[model samples]
Target: MNRNAMTYRLFPAVFLLASAVATAAGTATVTQPEKLREQPGSSSWSIMELHRRTTVRVLETRRDWVQVEADGNRRGWVREQSLSMDAPTQNAFASPTRQPVGTDLPPVPRTAPRASNHALLLSLGSAAPASRQDATHAAAIARLMGVPDANIRQPAQAELTLDGLRKALVDLDARMGDRDRAFIHVSGNSTRLREAGRCSTGFTLPTSKDVLTATELAAHVRSLAHRADKLVLLIDTRAGAGACQASEDTVTHSLNEGKSRNILYLGATQEASTTPANSQGGLFTQALLACLDGRATLSAAAGMPTGRELVDCTRTTLANHPGARPLVTLAGNGNLIPAPVMPRGDAISPHALLTALHAQRDERRQISVNGLRTNYRAGGKPMRFTLTSSQPGYLHVVAASNDGFTLLYPNQIDPLGRIERTLTVTLPAQDNQTRPAPRASQSKATLLFLVTDGPRNFFRAGLSRAGAFAAAPADARTLRDLPLEILGGDNSPTCTRSETRNLGPSQLLLCSTSFGSALQEITETP
Candidate 1:
């Protein structure tokens, strides 16, 4: 056909396309097993099967079929009868625990014993030349990982040569096991570590020696494998194409060699990258510090962070880098408590405590975790919070229970980080289901709320990879699965259990900073 003739022939289809673009768009759920036919009619060849409840965007409509796109791709026609355009009020896919609106949601403490619990904190690194900050950063991380200052082997800050790295690794291996002994109980580890007492000189090696070679790192792994019940190795170093050996390869090999699956592995970077540097320390190391200290604003029912939680939470916040996802290797149950939630700053702030009460023109009654014990019987009414703020900002909630402290609000949903003047949240009481052991005595826990001018971007950014987590309300199961501690301690009888030990007043630590926080002490009696 002539060019003029072809132009006229295409006008009708072009007009239809323009019309579809000018209108509003909505999502349609596929009602049944149907074909994404090339054309709207049944005679057209089928492209693929469309399953039920699949959200498809509506584009244009014909007499009996509608053209839609599934998951932003694969355009085709679905019978008009097979598409539901109405908004779904409940979950697109049914969940087992689906109940009422608020009841279904709002689901969901402690320190570890000092002597028994132990960790082998090292700056998993290369024979790369060192900086003063490097040595200080390694020691700082060891402390955050709950390694007693006495047990840490300080590497020379000026130049960490290969031989020095080897000696440190060898000394670490010695402390973890004797000539005949491979594994030790927490009680034994406590004694051995205390006796060792900063035995590592933290000296730099001469320039000639090479360290962190794959073979040597592997040897260190072999010796220490299955050496402790609860072990955490924080690798804040380079992970090149194969340099920073991840938990994947090392952990699996250890398990095969009769090592405990109880180990939780965390690395700062992957593949030819250095742990990004920040003012306080390496960016990733700082994230780990924030998570361990409870400043990351993540909480679990289990009192403190689980191995998975620690890795996941810390990696999540470090997502600002282009290739910033850190490696988190969880073996077996993967619920190792790396540290306790020790909130820094005074838990009680006059401005934060009074903001809610003053909004009602009532006398501001201040309370703190140590202020007063509000007691209630187990299985009674759930503890409720009526939080308010005169100023506009985001609201953060964390509680210290029999398990450890963790973040409560802003779990995937509420991304805006906005809060109302007043809102009510009902927390499940001390039930046998989540809280630790015999609900026979009065149990006490504390809740801390932080009010910030804008979003706790770190918290939200860290949890971004957990798709839909931001949209759903916090629940018991979610708490348990959280790579960190969500539910309080599972309390299973094992040398190394799911959660960490209880926190004492001595363990209360701080994060980098907080805008303002309010603390509440809740006492639940049997």
Candidate 2:
């Protein structure tokens, strides 16, 4: 056909296409299994899977693909051919005519192939010299994670003014990618006010005329959360009794409520509680630094601590301070490693080691191991514990300490680990002819027990003849599978035991997978 004839022939189809694009609103149901991709092309990375019948809000159309906002506010693109324009009759997707109301949606953020980790370590220290100290320690922690110094922003105390704070936040946002990890630590003095049954908190910096309110600060940090895979916020604000006496919402609540699930907040104190005065630094910051640096131990996997570890350690560190309550709100998985503190002789990243361990644990089957006491005086009596199981199985116990792993049970003196439904064992068996002295100094130990349907020999080659203890390998793979293993040495990351601290005398140290595992902590004092 000639040009004039072809133009007339395409006019109708073009008109229809314009009409469809202009009025493309409301929701659509997935016709089949589809990929929610990062971009409109099929070659784009899949953000998530859109199962059959999943209904999503249709934001806009791009030729063969359509942009959608799915559950959890996840925005991505799905093939138009995979979607049914008909919206669901019920649930959150019921309103086909309803369009998103309120602020204009920001462009979908893009994540790099290998995301980088960033930190904003603001001193905010005007009067409190300790705030500056906290910043230094936090920077050290960030360095361990391999975050470059340029990625760690430490604004001067004088630059903490209202305008300066905004500029700093903007600068940080510019540096962050969608998949980046963010660590934000703010240390300063704070004030809380209660009026008309509402509580408000503000950071009071001597250098700034205006106090930085929690609400204002959260607004800026909230944006960062949307751009990062994980954002850990550490607030070490020292508040007076007058600011903490009121019974109401806390500064933490204001900072994280209805925010992104990627955010993990660790505040110094809760509402109606004041941070104890610490000459070293903010009490929470001090404990955090200790946990990150291995000086203080709460819980660890492959020699690296998780977010829960930091929280548990902080709670313990502040337990003695009257009216001091450390506040923690974990919007993300607390089990995930917050800091990648690569300790000496450790070749594995904390996340990889934990992931490997988790794959070995079995959650369906459970075993409980109990100790006589969680605490013991140094140079006191030898430790003893009982293992209980519904099913008879072989037992393997390993002790973890600062010195490393030692196979406590199945040793030279008592070789057999065969157990019935219940068994009680002593550290230095009475059957032993030579008596070993008690622990000379104060230290903490985690006794991990793995009971399997069949016998599993882990670290058998490393066991010593005299003490009946085996030294574990320093490699990551051995450390990962050592927790739980069955006969024949299969890869079992199913029963990766999690570590927790108990307020009482007896604490549940670790619980593993289907292999039936348990762990208990023991404190030896001098």
Candidate 3:
């Protein structure tokens, strides 16, 4: 018969529970003999019997089978009658706390100090040609983040059975030692990506039909959140336009409510092909890999140049996307702290980075707040402002500060910190400036201009030198009609104009001019 048929045939007989009987002495013997199947008596086949009693732990019973855990903590199902549950066996199995069975086994304790206190769960993508790069990057990130590969629970590809996934999770749990931190990496392949998403819901593969669904993923993740001190989910995709968005949505929608506090999502944007060829991987992915490798930090790769800069690298990454824009949204009940500001002109040492992170926690004792804000510009206009306050959540600050623009939260400090509101000050116009006549030589040239109002320091100006000024008409409404000319007999383009304004030093406002051909030149007075 086929393997499926054989597996089906074995299922019914395997789950039949054995009757439990107690002796007068309150002790019981397992009368049933554990059955070990032998290959059909073929000339080349040999029966390998495993009779060792002391090396395994019978953790749980399912129908007639028991989940047997080996000394190495490898768990698998065994026939209910595989062994005699005599008084000695019963005593041995009764207390996992007691000495484990099996004298032939290595004398070294099977239970390592690190294994007892923590557990891990891992899910790998199901796609072929697994993204080894992502796996390697993830492992590195985990290490820097304080998780070692030895503690990681990698999925076994050879074992296509659902039992494989379960065994992996169990093994990971057994190996974690004392850190109850769970790190899950979702590499390429949509199916495995989907599976990882589902695992977060609580359903295990090989599970009955009753347990398979997206809801199970969220449930599992939620359950894991409660069981583990920290749970991190990392996804590495092709960064193809909507890939990151789709994956992020899947994660958000599948995760159980209130469990998001324990989760973190990282995605890379696809790179442009036209740009100078750098590497085979996506730019963002490469940056992330560098971060994992301990060669870079999110801030550094995002252009802050150093990790000490407490800037939101996400925005920078998005800004760098070739043809598309990237946006990162943090939603959940947990506090979002602004990473510490990187010291100016200093490379971020690991010690300094950690110290900054720790400082946020320390400051939290003094304040409590939570806030959320979205920062985006459309048509050079800024709009849409929303804030939610929590006594002990996050102090969301959205601004273009000198410290390289960022939206920060006091995560290391109190969650209930309040961010100052943005102040908008309109500059008064300068009426004393006279418009210069259009220069005859300014036409047919790309205009480089700067426009700002005069007195209050807000004015607009334009310039061109390739042709006569008549070629470029200026509209008073849009400043397109501004005169363009070369001043002081210089072959290079120049413009001069003077404007008077009444404003106090306290009211002065400084803003960078928009960089473009239009801002190339401004006619001004000597």
Question: Which of the numbered candidates is closest to the native, going by highest lDDT?
Answer: 2
TM-score of 3: 0.33
lDDT (Cα, tens digit) per residue for candidate 1, span 173-216: 65542111111110000000111222111111234333333334
Best by TM-score: 2
C-alpha lDDT of candidate 1 relative to the true structure: 0.42
Q: TM-score, each model?
A: 0.35, 0.43, 0.33
TM-score of candidate 1 on Cα atoms, chains taken together: 0.35
Instruction: For residue 372, give model 3's deviation from the true position in Å.
Output: 28
Candidate 3 segments whose C-alpha is farther than 4 A from its true place: 1-130, 160-163, 174-179, 191-214, 238-248, 254-256, 267-285, 292-315, 318-526
The per-candidate count of clashes, in order, stands at 45, 17, 75
Residue-level lDDT of model 3, residues 32-73, one tens digit each, is 222222321123232222332222344555676555433222
lDDT of 2 by residue, 288-334 (tens): 66556554435554455566666887676567445556564443445
lDDT of each: 0.42, 0.57, 0.30
